[model samples]
Target: MVLTPSSAPSRAPSYAAVLRTPHAACPFAAALLGRLSYGVAPLSLLLALKDATGSYSVAGVAMALFGAASVTLSPARAALIDRYGPRRVLPPMAGLYAALLTVIALATWNPGAPALLLGGLTMAAGACTPPLGPVMRALWSSLVPDRELLQRAYSLDGVAEELMYVTAPLLVGIVVTFTEPAAGVLAGAVLVFVGASALVSSPAVSRAHTARPPAGGPAGPRLHGIAALRHAVLVTAAVGLCLGALDLLVVAFTERLHQAAAVSWVLAALSAGSAVGGLAYGAVRWKSSSRVRLPVVAAALGAALLVAGVSPHLYALVAVVAVAGLFVAPALTTAYLIADESVDAARRTQAGAWVNTAFNAGSSGGTAVVGLLVDRLPIALCFGLAAAPALVCAAAVARAGARRPRTAGTGAAGRDAVSGA
Candidate 1:
């Protein structure tokens, strides 16, 4: 009863056309609405937790556990969607998560909540958070069967996500200014509950067998989608590492210049560049395949960061960061595309989740790794060290290509590789 993808288009299509795919807008919009909570939830919880516990240390610990649970369980959650379909799995997960957020908000509403209780609640909420992003990407594969169109869809998705993160913080900021952080948490809960509800009820879910029969057999004897995906994961983790490190590094960079306010401007510039680059990357028809492009984009990101370490002025640093940002969304979008195209249908959500998990884990790791380095090494060298992973991944993928050319995917992934990444 699995619903297969539509036939590939005869030619490349635009982003608008990708959205025009039958029943796509409904589920896509719903998923984004649900995912926007992702942008809002973390900061809200941190602030709310801090208010209730009245201890920054306790709040930090709670947030750490929350993130740990979410990231660690993401692939597991996505696997459920791949089996049961989003309609069947997403609703219950979203409900449980939303309910937990409600409890946390109530506890934090007036402060004085026990630290133990707050931490446990936040972790529980995180555990039940639905795999909305992964589910949406899997849906995209079915909705737009063509690689080019799918690329545009993913690019548009990445851009939207980037904007969501930027905008969500501002929304939370306004809320906290007027009321309390718990209100922000309440808003996040409502968004997910409503979004998941609407998304699951969409005709898109009802019309198709979004679930695949359990993925059968190993991908191949050796080095196929599995190996290719491994490359993407490693490079993505590397990108995550640099980005995670950049946040703290930028702060340190600005501290030296005595202009702490510039941090926002620099980071904003980075986001702006990513949106622009993702859009640009999507519009052009590529002559090279993502298998070839992943390493290049990863390296380009790393190269930009390397150059960023030496920026001489605030404007120069912002420009360099924006340039580095250019590769961020495109690199991530390419990685997601790799994950989507590399696996069979049943494994699509899990595959995408793993890439996501890698990026987040790498970011956390980067933050920790750079924290230790800043004390021992010069700032410029720390930047170089942060850039090392992407450069190394690029080299490794090229070396592997020389030794063997792997087949892309098996069991219904029929698309060919296209253009440089």
Candidate 2:
């Protein structure tokens, strides 16, 4: 049976409803595992590379390259999901990721071409990039009958992400210190493969990918990619730009402190804050769009940036990082919700992918810009400059709010039907 939003009941699902089916739980569990494992690999690789080479710069280079690869390929990955089913794509990717980890481990053991090749392979295998985030979002959209539940789901996702950042690095550090970084990487590989494979095997995910029914009468019109891009979405995309900048600012902050070893801690602080914000936002019963949350988040982020820019002490810097992160997930959750509601259900995934793509691009671009600023100016100046994007984002949100109608489901249904086709 097709589950459309229009057919959903008015009442919220009771605790009994939540318990009656196991499907709702599957995506959340899968998300937890996938996020945890993914978090470990980067921490392990960075620590291992830096320890072996005694060069934080080299570690940065490795990370930059990995991010570059992922950013470059993310859209193509989404397109592939659009074409081939996610089920067919994720498992092999997991296996290949495991092989690459083994190669990296061997490379660390011997430090040679085989390891280098594997590292490069790992980067290129963006083709197999696990669809954990997208798939989870899809499952949430399907399983939850209420829009509020969907909002809560994304908020919970943000919280889980925060928890991963909080613990993954420490775990990676401990494992590497007691044994070896290679061991930690290997463990991450194992967890990723196991968890991702299990998620792919779940009935809900499999059905969502393959259950496209035959169309009656012209199949309507395919949603023009351009038409799918709404002004609200465009505004929220700018918030992503700020986040990208913030990610880089944190890295640059660690470098300026000459405590490059603790860069991940700064990142964790940001993630933790975001997770807290998401959880808190999710708990609230507001039905407003990004119109409501975007400004609040933007103001918080701007203030945090100001503090980070001016603070001279490391503890103060960390505090500002946490404060800055406080708004990140909330802003992002708002963006996702806006994008989801703005587009047609059929085009929902594409819209969601567009948001992800924008965020990734923003992050990479923001980091590169901040990194250059750090080289040319004071760290304070770099941190201060990061706020510019957030300010721009806030302006865009205000403009969109002014133009947008108060309710989403009015005349937009005709527009959405045209688009969703």
Candidate 3:
């Protein structure tokens, strides 16, 4: 049952039809729960550290270390899942991650605990975190073999992720306000364990465990051999850089207005716009190649972000950001589709992980750069600087499109290679 575009029917399926397939619910729910925790954990960790240490610097350091550890370890963890399957990989790792978080929370509760110890614990927790996002993407490919339906599934996934991004912070905020920061962290731990357990136990995931590699071939492709994957990663990283800058810019904008509480609303508007855009993009079939679409959307995103950077008032900025956000998820969805179609079946999870890594790295770099600029320059300048990455991404995508036809062969072989041949 190796699925390919050639084998799927020509007619496109509705998203409702796709979701109605047997055994869809368990995996979808589990993936969503795990994703929510993924969104919630970072802020929870930061708040917990700040509560314990009474210094934003210490909290930032701990959070940065956690992110660094995850970025470094994600590819290796995803590779393991590809080789051994989620049933064997996810449950143990999820349990270990939860236990580590529990330990970090206990340490946070101990007011005298050293900051270094807490930072180390958070890093360890991040390293062991389950590769839920990559796994879920891989599962969708298996669940829906129709090319058109899969695109819709990915769009739905993107929309759900945006919702999580909007909701998780509020959830963390509520927990922190009512209970304690450590409770928020502990809540994330509980979600991770519960979600991972359900995902691993699902029949679909269990079947994926026995999924064999390409016949008479190895379990994965050589990374250096794939041009599409390399380009996809680069494009995705650039998008991430702009997003990182936007995150900080919003904070700076709210702080300058002395309405710090408004930051969440501004960010949520962006996510909401992305959610709407993703649904629309997924619903319609595109005649152009993904490579072409990638650059066009990236350029539009850069243009919109440039406008947001210069907005004169809080209301104006929020409106611009919302408009800018319409392009964000579509760009990412394009990147994921490029990666999915570029790699061999056995390497799909690994390819997705690489995309995630690029985004995280870009976001980290963007945040650091914007953080430095915020102290020295006007916030508008910082916003303009953020737009730089999106422009670079557009250029990179255009260059990749130019090179694709030359390096890719003609007819079936070339098409297969380009489309996960």
Candidate 4:
């Protein structure tokens, strides 16, 4: 069933042919819009709650509740999509998100109702979060006939992810700062509802649904679950945990310095560094499989974490963080690629969801642990704590390499052949 350029359709496509293609530019555009909407909600929720309650602590709590709910429900939501097509499920989910957003806006203006409405809205929205990345990946797999084209497609996706975080927040911030922050939340809800609906309605997505195998047939290769149990997955999860710990460490440092506003600048610097790294990695012609690249990048990340822990000054910490972040996209992209390569085509969505869930769970756990450390000891200790777990992750990866040896000669070919959903 392996596909190649020689097996592709013979004519230059007309508009109809382009429209019917499973993976096309339009679907990618739709995915971008949907992700943009999801990114805007957090800032909006915090602002709306703060404006109404005049309690920053209460607003923070509301945000936490929303995150908790999303973390708990996202897997079930993803599973539902696996059982039923996204086209059938997305519209109603989007509609639910819109209605709950209205409820949150109403609650913001009313003092009687609790801020819990905001949390509920966040959970609903997150639960219904369009499987944009997964869906697009699947589409690309179906449409493109060549492995090189798929790599290029995934590289484009990596670029889109960087763009989403960059532009999404700035635009959201502008709207929130100028108009009512609640308006920003309303806008995000509308975008989610509209964008997701449009994506599902697209001919590309519809075709994927129609292409499903018979219900009772033996399912496609289940790579994600198998990959999840592998050492690579554990190492990747550990990397996520380290990043989360780093986040808490920054917060602790800011609090200790009594310049909490610096958090925004520091985080931005780290993100900027990651953007650079992603671009660099995407551009390079590496002769190594994802297995080789992942462990090496992760070990490098651990070393960077070690440096961050030892650094005393804020400037030094920022530098180290930026350095570490430079490889963030490559690490994430590789981990996802591995997950996709391991799973069956039909089960790709579920596998992707599981990978997302694992990363989130690891990060949340890291945040909790680091937060506790910050509360108990000096802020410097928080940064130091980040390195310990990173070292452990590095060790786990090294051990995995010893146990499941990879031939150096086949590495490049294996990496080049990466086929993602």
Candidate 5:
């Protein structure tokens, strides 16, 4: 079912068209269900630990352990998926994660759970957490070979994930209001297990598996095709670093204005702008390949952030932040698209994982680094400094992308990549 431009939708593909691809809806929904756990489980864990330990410091430490394990090991988990295929690997991982969460929930259900126990179990849970998001992105590359439709799909995914995070905390709020926060952890356990079960059942997942190389050797062929991923990961990290700084910078901006209540609105605007930008960017029919487009979008985001701190009023800052947000999803979407193009189907999950890892690691770094600078430097100047990474990284990517030659056909010739959607 390999599809060419003539067989696929027009240059500007709609999200609806992307979803309508054969056997797409069910697995995608299943992946989202699993991903919802991701949005909910962490917050629930934080709350549960806080309730159990009666100490914010203890809760923070446990949560930090969980996040670090999850982010740091994402690529390794994805490598397993890449080697064994999602259908084979995702279920076991999800099952283990759900079981660990159940144990965590029970341990915290009555409070007085030992900190040592909680920390160990949470980290173990994170380590076993299935790489659902990366798998789903790889699946998209499998189901939709047409690059245009795939772009639309990734954009749709980023927006959906954004919404999931926005709503997940509210779900936690409701659960905790009525019962123990430990109950929220139990709920997450249910969600992920059910989602993974259903996702692996999809016919589309059958197509996700590729011929694996012999074990005991490095990913021989898979590693060869992924050279282009270097630039994608680099720019993605820079974008993530900028975004991580923005969280604190926005807080500083609000504090300076003595308008703490406005912080939520500014953050909301950023999310909204990103959602809008993602959809728009996906629907556009770009002639350039993603290798070139990646750096361009990264640069746009950097430029917006560079001038955002100069805003004199809350309203102005919000507007500029919103504008900066416009580039956020597009940059991520484009980066994922680059991963899709650079890696073959067998290695696709790992490819996505690497991008995710870089972005998340950069975000952690940005938050810590920006915390140090917010006190010493002017807020505006801090904003400018934050922009430096994106600008500098984008130039590096631009140079690398320039040296690479464009593909002759649909950008999937050698990679066995996207066919249609």
Candidate 6:
């Protein structure tokens, strides 16, 4: 099913056409809900922990533990999905994760609860959160086998992700306003459970499972050996670092302006820019290879951030930040494309999960690094530091693209040729 220059259409299929395909709706809706919860849960955790302990330090520690657990455990959980299929893996994990979240929410209300107990629950909950993003992306290959259409699907998913980020925080705010911070946690838990259950039940996802090989057959290459996958993970991690720094920078900048109330709008603007960019990128039929396009886009993103570093006013900062975010979803969607093309079908979920884990790790590290620098250095200098990782990502992508052969095709044949090398 590899689509070479000869096979691909002069114009890519419309996003609407891709969406109209049979069995597309269920997985999309389910994944959307699950991803929205994924967006909400961490902030909800922070708020809940802060409310319960009455100390931001304890809350930070709990969040750190939760993030660490997710980064540590995701690959193993994804491997389980790859081998046993989502039907068997997602449901049970989702249920356990939901239960843990509820327990954590209730514990947040107990004045006498120990810090150690709360931290453990947070970590466990993170460890158990379903690998919805990876699973859904993996399903796209089977659900829409056409390379061009699949690219469109990924782009649409990326745009949906931007919407989720924009909406989730608002949802959390509303929940926290009407109820307690712990109520936000409970709401996120419910979303995860219901969304994951519906997703796993979808026929598209059910049919997309890769069966385990017979016990005696040769296993696939070690994760490190898969150059495309490794590169995708590294590039994604770098992007995550940029995102993490930007998040803190926005907060610091807004706080400095004595307009903290504008933070949400500022962040929403960035997400909106990304959504627009992703839609545009997906709609066009690009003549260039993904390898070539990836670095170019990364460099553009870095340059935008560098300009943002020197912005003189809140309006200028917002403008540059939105411009920088324009490339975020496109770059990520391309990285996912690379991972999908780089690994064996049986190992795709694992590779996707590892990429996600790397991104999360980088974000956690970036936040810690940027938080320290926000007070110590000038705001502009902090932004320049944030742009550094994006530049590194560009360099890494350029190097990887140079090493790989040029391919107009990005299907089974293209992937097989790459993997075989």
What's the residue-level lDDT of 408 in candidate 6? 54
Deviation of model 3 at 118, angstroms: 1.3
Candidate 1, residues 1-74, lDDT tens digits: the string is 11222345545678889888999998888888988899898899999988888899999999999989999999
**Model 2 Cα lDDT, one tens digit per residue, 298-351:** 756876887788877778877888888878887777666665555444444555
lDDT of 4 by residue, 1-421 (tens): 1111223344333333333445487777787787787678778877888887778888888777777666666657665666687888777877887777766766775444565655566566555555566666666655664444455555557666776877777987799667777787788778777778777877877777667554324544433336432645676677778888888787777777787888777777778877777766654445455655677777778788778777777788788888988867777766666665655556556656655666667788888888778788765566666666656765766566557544443344343223332
List the candidates' TM-scores in order: 0.92, 0.79, 0.91, 0.83, 0.91, 0.90
Query: Which runs in model 2 stand beyond 4 Å of their true positions?
Result: 1-22, 49-60, 114-119, 210-269, 311-320, 344-347, 378-380, 404-408, 411-421
Where is model 2 poorest over a 10-residue stretch in terms of lDDT?
A: 412-421
Ranked candidates (TM-score, high to low): 1, 5, 3, 6, 4, 2
The C-alpha stretches of model 3 lying farther than 4 A from their native spots are 1-11, 214-225, 257-260, 406-421
Error of 1 at 88 (Å): 1.3
- For each candidate, the alpha-carbon lDDT, in order, equals 0.84, 0.64, 0.80, 0.67, 0.83, 0.80
Provide the clash count, candidate 4. Answer: 5
Model 5's alpha-carbon lDDT is 0.83
Q: lDDT score, residue 183, model 6?
A: 84
Best by TM-score: 1
Question: What's the CA RMSD of model 1 in angstroms?
Answer: 5.2
**Residue pairs with clashing backbones, model 1:** 286-419, 287-419, 288-418, 288-419, 288-420, 289-418, 293-421
Candidate 3 clashes: the total is 1
Error of 6 at 282 (Å): 1.2
Error of 2 at 289 (Å): 2.1
Query: Candidate 6: deviation at residue 357, Å?
Result: 1.6
lDDT value for model 2:
0.64
Counting only residues 3 or more apart in sequence or on different chains, how many pairs clash (N, Cα, C under 3 Å) in candidate 2? Answer: 1
lDDT of 5 by residue, 156-263 (tens): 999998888878989999999999999999999999999999999998887657443343344333332356678789899999999999999999989989998899
